[model samples]
Target: GAGVSQSPRYKVAKRGQDVALRCDPISGHVSLFWYQQALGQGPEFLTYFQNEAQLDKSGLPSDRFFAERPEGSVSTLKIQRTQQEDSAVYLCAVQRGFGYTFGSGTRLTVV
Candidate 1:
C-alpha cells in the first residue's frame, strides 16, 4: 500500500477475549510504531520496531500486550484477556524521511 493500512477499524470484545490488531506499513518503510490512545487522552507509545527486530517495548502496558513485525512490513498487536481499561484506539505508524505515515487506527472496546 502507498500508505499505512489497518484492519478491523472497529472491534467489540468480551471481557476475557483476546484481540489482534493488524497494520501494514508503506512499502520500504523501515520504522514502525504502535500507540494506544485512551479516550480523552493523547496517544501513548506502545512499541517500536526497526525492520524485523523490536527495538523497544517498554511502553507496552503489561505482559498481556504483545506486538511483532517478524517480516518487517506488516505488524500485529495482540491483547489477552481484554479489559475495560484496554478500550482505546490502536494506532500504527511508519517513519521515513523525518516524518510518519499513520493508519486510521483500530478502535477496540472491551466489555
Candidate 2:
C-alpha cells in the first residue's frame, strides 16, 4: 500500500451487530495504531502495534473491542456488540517521525 486506506468509509450497524474495520498502511511502516473520534472531540487512542506485535492495548475501552496487525502491513479493528457509545470514526494511523499519517477512517453508526 502506498498510503493509508480504510474500507467501507461508512458503516451502519444494529445495536447488537459486530463490525470490522480495516486499514492498510504504507508498505514499510512499523509503528502505531487505531483511534476513535467522536463528534466535537479529539481522537482517542485505541491500540498500538509495532510490526506484527501488539505492544500496548491499554487504551481499548472494553473487552468487546479488539485490534490486530497481522504481518504488519495491514490491520483490523473489530467491535463486538455495537452500542450507541461506539458510534464514531475509527482511524488507522502509522507513526511517521513525530507525526502520524491517518487514514480516512470508518464511520460507524449504530441504530
Candidate 3:
C-alpha cells in the first residue's frame, strides 16, 4: 500500500461554511490519527481510530467538529459553522511498520 493521502490540498471557506476533510490511509494499516495545527503551533490531536473503532476523540475543540473511519480505510473530518479562527492545516496519519506515514495536509482558510 502507498502512504497516507489527504484531499482538497487547499480549501477556502466563508465564515459559517461547513467543510469535510478527507484522508485515505495505506491499506492494511490498523491505526489512524488526525490533528489540527494552527500557525506557529504544533499539531493538536483531534481524533484517533483503530480498525474502525474510534479510540479517542479528546482533542476536538468544540461540538462543531467530528470525525469517523467507518470501515478503517478512509476517514473524514467535518467542521460545522466554520469560523475565521478555524483556519489551519488539518493533518492525517496512519501507523505503518515502526512509525507513521502522514498526509500533506489540508490548508483551510475562512474569510
Candidate 4:
C-alpha cells in the first residue's frame, strides 16, 4: 500500500476473547510503532520496531499485549484475553523524515 494500512477498522470482542490487529506500513519505512488511544486522550506508545527487531516494548501495558514485525514491512498487535480496559483505538504508524504517518486505526470494543 502507498500508506499505512490497518485492518478491521472496528471490532467488537467478547470478554476474554483474543484479537489480532494488523498493520501494513508504507514500503521502505523501517521504524514502526503501535499506540493505544482512549477516547479524548492522546495516543499512548505501546511498542516500537526497527525493521524486524523489537527495540522497545516498555510502553506496553501488560503481558497480554504483544506486537511483532517479523518481516519488517508488516506488523501485528495481538491482545490475549480481551478485557473491558483493553478497548481502545489501536494505531499503527511509521516514522518518516521527521514525523510519522499513521493508519486510521482499529477501534476495539471489549464487552
The local distance difference test score of each candidate is 0.93, 0.90, 0.92, 0.93
Report clash pairs, candidate 2. Answer: none
Give one digit per residue, the lDDT tens place, for model 1 in 1-111.
348999889999999999999998757789999999999999999999999899999999999999989998999999999999999999999999898878999999998
lDDT agreement of model 2 with the native: 0.90
Q: Which residue window of length 10 is worst by lDDT in model 1?
A: 1-10
Per-candidate TM-score against the hidden true structure? 0.96, 0.94, 0.94, 0.96
> Per-residue lDDT tens digits of candidate 2, residues 1-111?
237899979999999999999998855788968999998899999899999999999999999999988898889999999999999999888986797888889999999
Instruction: Give the root-mean-square deviation of each candidate in angstroms.
Output: 1.3, 1.6, 1.6, 1.3
TM-score of 1: 0.96
lDDT of 3: 0.92
Q: Local error of candidate 4 at 54, Å?
A: 0.4
Off-target runs (Cα >4 Å) in candidate 3 are: none
Instruction: Give me the displacement of residue 47 in model 2, in angstroms.
Output: 0.3
* Residue-wise C-alpha lDDT for candidate 4, range 18-100, written one tens digit per residue: 99999998676889999999989999999999999999999999999999989988999999999999999999999978988
Off by over 4 Å in 4: none
Question: Model 1: how far is 94 from its true place, Å?
Answer: 0.4
